[model samples]
Target: MNEDEILARIRDIFQDNFGIEPSKVTPEAHLYEDLDLDSIDAVDLAIKLQEMTGRRIKPEEFKTVRTVGDVIGAVESLLAA
Candidate 1:
């Protein structure tokens, strides 16, 4: 999928998982600060993303992902590779 499509999917997942409004989710929005996602939510988000994309996203990868766009970019890069 294209970047925009991937981002939209990611946003859907975030909304479903975290109860965050789609309109509030943005490329620069931080999961913790903006969405109020705790550590447990972070773990769940990673696992759900892995299941949805069939990609193995390590814990280390999440450490570098600070925003919704970062997660989308990481997933896209993994799919590309």
Candidate 2:
């Protein structure tokens, strides 16, 4: 999927999983600082991402994700691969 599509999916995932509004989940929004996601939330997000992409989200692969855009980029890269 393209970046925009990936972002939309991310927004949906966050909203459905954590009740975050799409309007608040901007590209620059920090997962921890802005979205208030803790370590458990991050792990949940990884599971959701893996389900969405139909791929395994290794712990190492998820370590670099810190922002909404970063998640989108990661998903995009996975889709591309």
Output the number of the lDDT-best candidate. Answer: 2
Q: Which stretches of candidate 2 lie over 4 Å from their true place?
A: none
Residue-wise C-alpha lDDT for candidate 1, range 1-81, written one tens digit per residue: 888888888889888988888888888898899889898998998888888789888788778888988888888877877
The CA lDDT at 55 in model 1 is 80
Give residue 52's error in model 1 in angstroms: 1.7
* lDDT tens digits, residue span 1-81, model 2: 777778888899889989999988989999999999999999999989888988887798889999998898888877777
In order, the Cα lDDT scores of the candidates are 0.85, 0.89
After superposition, the stretches of candidate 1 with alpha carbons farther than 4 Å from their true spots are none
TM-score of 2: 0.94
| The best candidate in terms of TM-score | 2
lDDT of 1: 0.85
